[model samples]
Target chain A: SQKIEQNSEALNIQEGKTATLTCNYTNYSPAYLQWYRQDPGRGPVFLLLIRENEKEKRKERLKVTFDTTLKQSLFHITASQPADSATYLCALDILMDTGRRALTFGSGTRLQVQP
Target chain B: EPEVTQTPSHQVTQMGQEVILRCVPISNHLYFYWYRQILGQKVEFLVSFYNNEISEKSEIFDDQFSVERPDGSNFTLKIRSTKLEDSAMYFCASRYSPQSSYNEQFFGPGTRLTVL
Candidate 1:
């Protein structure tokens, strides 16, 4: 069985500071890793996706890094703002034993950017 | 930009009743999926549909659940007998492709199903 863990507590920080969220997994070999942003009462929006071959990926102010050797992925929001306050989820492509299928998921970490 | 859309933003149904959640995925997208999030729980995958058939489904998707693309525009999930435990926010998502390319799924606002 595989376990994905993220900081369950809400991350509080002053606006404009960098917010780093960690996602660690165990007992599974993922084909790819992804990060998503979910606001209350809304569906998660895709933020970034990084493959095992790639060490890091970036889009605008958001960045994601995947280290398969460590079975971990970290999502970073630099120059964070109040608007960036939301729950962030890190999902991995869980391939079944057949190795042709995958699913997306993560427990999610709550983030609160204080003004 | 096109987005996935779901109807009946909120639905409350009695236990054992049948409920159908509807979604209209992005027109050009080929892969469609359903996921649910119980309050205070992680978002869990329900099923994935591609090319008019189920590609993969999670263990949580039991016999009580079924999916349909009744028409060209609508993708639906029908619960034959809704249980109280089924109460959760159901999200509908779609992706353009899943064949080793830039496969990203676009999600809808979700329909909150409350089974009482």
Candidate 2:
């Protein structure tokens, strides 16, 4: 079985600082990885994705780096704001026989930005 | 931008009762999905629908659970008999072909199901 472990600790950082979240996986290597942001009582919103071949991907204030050899990925939110406080999740693309269209998600790390 | 919309942001039902959560995905997207998240747990995939049929489903999507796209605009998940463990937030998502975009998914507001 595959398991993705993300830091369960709530991170508290000052606004404008860089926030780095880590995701580590065990078992099969994934073809692709994704990051999403979720607020309380809300669905996750897609952030960025990096393929096994890609080292890094970026979108505005967010950046994602994947190291397949290490079986880990890092999600960074730079110039963070109070509004950026939310749980960040990492998911790996899975192919379960039914044909590859689903993702296996991690527990997610909660972030708290203080202004 | 077109968005996926779900009905009854919150629903409460008794155990063993049938519940149908409805969603209207973005008009032009070719893929649709259903995912559930138990409070404080990781989001789990339920099923995926495309071309008016089930493309993939998870173990959690047992016989008691079913999905249907009755019309051109509506996508639905029906739970034959709601269980107390069925309490969770159900989300509807849509996406265009991987060739068209970065495989990004657009999610709905989610319907919170509370089984008593």
Which candidate gets the maximum TM-score versus the true structure? 1
Off by over 4 Å in 2: B98-102
Tell me the tens digit of each residue's lDDT in model 1 across B34-80: 99999888899998898899888988899999999988989999999
Each model's fnat? Answer: 0.69, 0.86
Model 1: residues with Cα > 4 Å off, grouped in runs: A97-99, B98-102
Tens digits of per-residue lDDT, candidate 2, A1-51, equal: 788999766899999999999999999578889999999999899899898
User: Taking the tens digit of each residue's C-alpha lDDT, what string does model 1 give over A1-115?
Assistant: 6799996668998999999999999998877788889999999999998988999999999988888898889889999999999999988888765445556687898999999
lDDT of each: 0.90, 0.92
User: How many pairs of residues in model 1 come into backbone collision?
Assistant: 0
Docking class of 2: high
**Using Cα atoms with residue i matched to residue i, what is each candidate's TM-score against the true structure?**
0.97, 0.96
Task: Report the number of clashing residue pairs per model.
Answer: 0, 0
